[model samples]
Target: MSSALAQTLIVMPAFNEEDAVAGVVAEVRAALRGVHVLVVNDGSRDDTVGEARRAGAAVVDLPFNLGVGGAMRTGFKYARAHGFRYVVQVDSDGQHDPAGVPKILDALQTHDVAIGARFAGEGDYTVRGPRKWAMKVLAVVIGRIAGTRLTDTTSGFRGAGPRAIEIFAEHYPAEYLGDTIESLVLAARAGCTIQQVPVTMRERAGGTPSHAPVKAAVYLGRAAIALVIALWRPPLTLQPEAGTTP
Candidate 1:
């Protein structure tokens, strides 16, 4: 296989997505030809693992639910171990459009990380009012901390090149923070070059959102505080091994 064909892996974190996981995996496989797909089944109570495997993705079953952060970190560790050159993170809720995978891959050629920004494009879907406000607030806070204007700090659709994959696999934040903003901010502080691309996301097709509106606001508030504290203090330094790219 060509280098581009062999080096990419789509990492999906799924929780009780038995109904949607298969379709999402198939879509990713179809959209990114020659790229492998790995689904981190976070102790799902249903048949998520079996469906993911049947849909042509390799499955990593967590012993118990570790939330999104834990599942994604597990995928990152696997990417680092297996020497993948790029890792793309997507939710299994059927909201993210897999057709945009190529755009992310293209962005990775010049950026350490490429994130899909829902607010950056002409997306028919809009975030819930409360969540939208919270995202805006968090973005401003993260921008001040990272010294850059970050538009979509709470988006889960993101791509990490080799260097970023290695760094995150080694030293990702431990606590679950709902959105991936904290990790993105930490990556920025660590001197990673991050970029964002506009992508349209559809409304979720199956399964209820893990967070309700009020719960999401509270979660974002706490995570924002944690991110500020994390920025003030230096993070644990991790050295990449020889020959590792990310």
Candidate 2:
């Protein structure tokens, strides 16, 4: 936890994940030594806050459920307020592997944002049927919008350097679809380097995935529309005044 070593904060957004939060926190703590873990308990009906706290994470309880975008926004606000130099976003569903944290941190050595691409390497992780199709279509659209080849646009497992964190904290899209894509696109547009690393994703360990088949379809449809709207509008620019630190 020395000042010389970048202060890294790992943000896990959980909703009704009481069964998995403790295990997730333990894995992340073991994998990424010296990193602070912050759990955004997004109004979980279960005892997610208690479990996370028991697992040695700093828990931030939301007054009510605000979806994924709101939960992550809270994490970003915490990162900014606490002066963390790096922020890592990990899914609480247990799909993302904490073991890949080293690769992500290494990638950030030269890149502003390092994303874990589930489809990048040979692994047991598989997104099949309609979900796979939806991801493919979304990836193509995101790549076109960002003018960069993006293999995984929807993966929540990613790392953001201080510059990217400031930008996200200042203007994270309030909507779900726009929130994920806008962060990456904005980082690239601001001359921040973006890179990807291969990582394996596993099935959820506890509660069911929030995105069911029908829900996935609806999300894809909405995401497509949002992407079009986002493209029509100009990208937002970061307005950091001199000597200001986010």
Candidate 3:
């Protein structure tokens, strides 16, 4: 039983989240039993590594801050190498409620990727001005391309099955919103089952969000270009499955 639990890895990508990493890791442990927790400390200048380790999570200290996508990519590679059957991502900044991770893991019973969507319903997550508009636009564009509606294109709380873990290990993006946006499109194109579940988010455990207003605008433009490019790309190396998880 102990050995079997080793196949599931809960990855937390952290940068300057010292204030939140310990509590977040603790919450994950409390919420999910027997799952291995890994903290990918992305060159945090603070005590993220020390705190996460002290909180009883395995720590992978990156040489530099690789952003969320890059840090998560590294985590996926580790999961792939270690033969983890599932990878559930948790936000180190405490925005993602650890209790919600089980929902994603459970969804993976039928879906290849399960996203904890803040806007799926029953959540207080909302942005203002152009960012909100961009999110709505992205939802439509991605919904059309993915053949399903996805309310939150920027939520980092997600889970991956074996195949997704393998693919993302090799080619996960590392830019602003790169982890959430690119991963969704790639997973969709791969013909993997994708799903979203309603989840309420928390205020950041600590540190600022990546989506500052100025950065959000630049990211909006860049993400738009990327989304268009994704339309022309062929499906991923993994075989596409027929039908999807509702």
Q: What digit string (tens of lDDT, one per residue) describes model 1 on residues 17-71?
A: 9989999999878877788899999989999999999999999999899888888
Q: How many clashes (backbone atoms < 3 Å, residues ≥3 apart in a chain or on different chains) does model 3 have?
A: 1
Model 1 residue runs over 4 Å out of place are 1-5, 216-220, 236-246
lDDT of each: 0.80, 0.78, 0.82
How would you order the candidates by lDDT, starting with the best?
Answer: 3, 1, 2
Write model 2 residue lDDT over 80-117, tens digit each, in one string. 99988778888887888988777777777667788888
- TM-score of every candidate relative to the true structure: 0.89, 0.89, 0.90
Q: What is the Cα-based lDDT of residue 183 in candidate 3?
A: 77
Q: What's model 1's lDDT at 220?
A: 54
- lDDT value for model 3: 0.82
lDDT of 3 by residue, 1-246 (tens): 334345679999998888989999998888778889999999989999999999999999999988888999999999988879889898888888877777787778777888899887767778877678888888887766678778887778889987788789987877556687877888888777788888889888688676566776665687787676665567677844336332
Instruction: Give the winner by TM-score: 2 or 3.
Output: 3
Which predicted model would earn the best TM-score? 3
